[model samples]
Target: MVSEMSKKREFKDDEELEHGKVVKRFNGLPQFNLQRFCYRHNPDVQSSVGSTTCYKQDANRLKSVNDKISQLPKNEREEVHHVVSTFRKSNDKLRKLMLEGILTACCFPQLSYVASEVQNMIRIDFISILPQEISLRILCYLDCQSLCSAAKVCRRWKTMADDDRVWHRMCEQHIDRKCPNCGWGLPRLHMKRARNPTPTRCTELITPWKAIYRDRFKVECNWRKGQCVIQEFKGHMDGVLTLQFSSRLLFTGSYDSTVAIWDLCSGRLIRRLSGHGDGVKTLYFDEQKVITGSLDKAIRVWNYITGECISTYRGHTDSVLSVDSYKKIIVSGSADKTVKVWHVESRTCYSLRGHTEWVNCVKLHPLSFLCFSCSDDTTIRMWDIRTNACRRVFRGHVGQVQKVIPLTIIDIENLVVDDKQTSDPPTDDPHDPLTEDLPYPTHILSCSLDNTIKLWDVKTGNCVRTQFGHVEGVWDIAADNFRIVSGSHDGTVKLWDLQSGKCIHTFQGKSLQEPHDQQAETAPHKVSPIACVGIGDSEFFTGDEMGYVKRYRFDTT
Candidate 1:
């Protein structure tokens, strides 16, 4: 060991810090970049700053500094801590010198003590007096999650981050930001493989976000900052059961037992058509008309333009559970164990009777004009709509099959569907469940009373995967060829990956415990399960057994 009296540890000038002599005498050296420390502390120093070798040397010097610190006496350690803590409270040069003097007396502990102090004092409030623009720029340099959390810390920060310009810049930095369905210029194989385990359809994952921003409040809209508007559609009573949009109109069926048509662009409540005696269960629209199924055991066809109920077809003895229409025919399934077909214009109905229990949902294959239905019997039925016969039964679910959709089917249904329309065909065709361009019709999603969501290959008649996490039976399923949205009896909606079947996030409207405890029975099926689900843009909407409806905007930045 070197003699203490002969060792000169204190630096007389900045140039000495660049020399290795001070550290050469010590053993407890820290693994740090002394050159970075030198540059940060004295920006005027112009040494050889461009060499990698210099960095390695700084690392060695840091090691020496730490080694020397380990040998400090106990009183010196306490004195160092006290001086450093006091120094952090003010930026005076005298205080910094005093702190350095005490730390040197304690054998100069590693700069990590300084780094820790800096990190602990790195709150955004330090620059609150600075120009809002510059302060926001500094905030943006932080991680996205921290920025979001900081914005929520107080009303002042919330107002600052609410600036659309800041949010738009933040959005650009997120790795998983892209079109909801489009991969960011990636090839199909990489995209598919990337999607397989995670099943994120697009290149990037989007969190459903619902934060208000400054641009939304401005009368002079700047689309460049990103177009976000608080558009509200009003018509439903209690809550809306389900909503669907076409090129021109938005159709909403509600707990009030009525279907309302609204102008999509204006968010205006155009007209409300009343027919169902109980809450509407589900509704969909094709080129020809709006088809609605309700708890009143009826499926009604309405004129899209006039909002007039054109024809009401009734056959099922119990409440109609789901209705989906293609080309000219309306297919409806009911709690009464039957799938019925109706002619949109003539109002004639034919029942496809085979299910042993409640038919929960119906989907039409576009090409073959096949009709598929899932039921409480734990089975899915594939039918030939033309023959009105059951073509096949896919049975394997431990709980009810809440939904069935065909990714692609024949063109015959579209031809028949187009001929029945009173208006011209849409210029750009709306999304059809039966187009061959989409992936396998086998990609099926079903929710069940068993507190799980199941994905299946309906064409292969195989259950592909099961997603568990929902505390109650899943009542409905919706997807965008990547992620699956499920509604549950647990009073929440969940988003899950189709491939891994992992739950990514959940959205809840109300707590099940908040409702009447007496109404909640211990019986397995006693609670109202999620009855229906629909997705719009970044929002997921769920309707429950008690007629409550809620919308949750995902939290993607």
Candidate 2:
């Protein structure tokens, strides 16, 4: 309720004086007054801190003020209250004048008392008072650890810190790409619904973005610390050669001329797919079908669901070395010294023939409509699938190129590599961004019989970085946004940081033990080469020459 004096007094509406013709409201701030309270201590606003206990300094100030007031006579206390109430209702200029007059009348000891009290009272809860938009903008600048700490401050803080919009920005910084500030990148979640951070209307129920970020962050930490449990799968009669996996199952191809599918959760054989006439050398699969290439010189498509061979494609006269596909387009590399792109629906086959020696790897990058092939000829070629013409040739490897993986490396030029010829990788800043606007892949990772893994700049066709860890040849390698997993002829598996090009962890070869055996064997088993490798969201699989596959699971939960 307004006092009668306030009701009678006329005050001017807030407006800015025009030095020019146009006039405007004084500011965008809400209309307010100093009587009941204002910016300093508004009755309408909640207490700054949410906890039940008062802050120590605030409690001390309150105790001292109450002590002084209680000591005064009843009549003097009423006079003091009137003076304080008048000061609270005064405008800024009047209050400052009143403060100066009070200070002038005080002696040194009194001035010292006022100074100490003012110091304790000056601090404010700015994040709580600022408009939410400005508050969130301030929070956005904080890193993950700092942001998480802020969430524990209070209920209001937790709501703002765990906001979907804030977590969405966090995901955008670290998902499928390295964050420039922290040098950390998280694996992209396979589920499109959760990973796709699309904006929603205010009325719509938003996804739990902070939870998604937390789970992925845990997996990334496991990868970095090399914390994992190893599970071995054994059944093939000959050397295990290639493997791939989904969220729930693991697939392996072997020199036994068969493909094996195992339940990843149960660690049991789900199916034994037997159709290839010779050793299965390479394979790729999705939810619908499994495509395998064999030393028998044929590419076979199987309906793994029913354990049936849906189709057989025989065109290469020599052993099929590698295979990859997208849509109806199947690309195959062979000892016939060629890479074949088969459009199954159109019944058309286009041959890419620049490689002089056996083509060892074929990779299809569907997004750019391009195919990458590395060969024993010591060259990696990027081909335009639409034209069947080799767009560029990368020539640097001294030995056969065993694998080629097209990649989108963030800040590819920053990594240090050892290529023997150049003792150091270039630390020069990246070239123009427009030069990187090409539809083709940004970089390529290739391992060779040369016993080294190389990172290449796709646009410049130059080997930018080389990783050397395996004492023998790096036969096969797999990579994701965060790290690289390589299986080598040295009878070891190595994990690498893709960003830094540094070897992080290495596992020595170990033989599988019989699960049914009652007595454990004390004898040491023979070590064999790791011929193939596959990587998933929180795990990686290595298939060795002894017909054994090991799954390294990194997720703690």
Best by TM-score: 2
List pairs with backbone clashes in candidate 2. Answer: none
Per-candidate TM-scores read 0.50, 0.79
TM-score, prediction 2: 0.79
Question: Which digits, one per residue and each the tens of the lDDT, describe model 1 over residues 1-557?
Answer: 33453365554433233343443312111212344444333222112221124432345555675677668898886776675467657656877788677567663356667767678434324333345667678776665456668777666566665555675554444322222222211111111112235545552332222122221212112111222232444456555667776545667787789887777556577788887799787898877678888998887878877777887777889998888877777788999899888876675789899999999889887567688898989888887777788856666678877777654222212111112232433224343333445343544556778776655544445555566798777767786533567877676677764334567666554444535566456633343456667754344556654545444433222
- Cα error, residue 533 of model 2, in Å, equals 0.8
Q: After superposition, how far is residue 339 of candidate 2 from its true place, in Å?
A: 1.5
Those runs of model 2 whose alpha carbons end farther than 4 Å from true positions after fitting are 1-36, 46-60, 68-91, 94-119, 192-207, 411-438, 511-526
- Give the per-residue lDDT digits (tens) of candidate 2, residues 1-557: 24444456554564433342223342222222224445445422334444223422235556788799989999999999899889968988999999999999999999999999789667655566666777788888788999989988887777788788898899888888888888788877673444445546732433478767877888888888889898999989999999999988788999999999999889999899998889999999999999999999999999999999999999999999999999899999999999999999999998889999999999998878789999999899988888898878888888899999999866655666555535444434364222434576788999998999998876666687888888888889999877899998888999998877889999887645465654546655436889999888788999998898998888764
Error of 2 at 201 (Å): 28
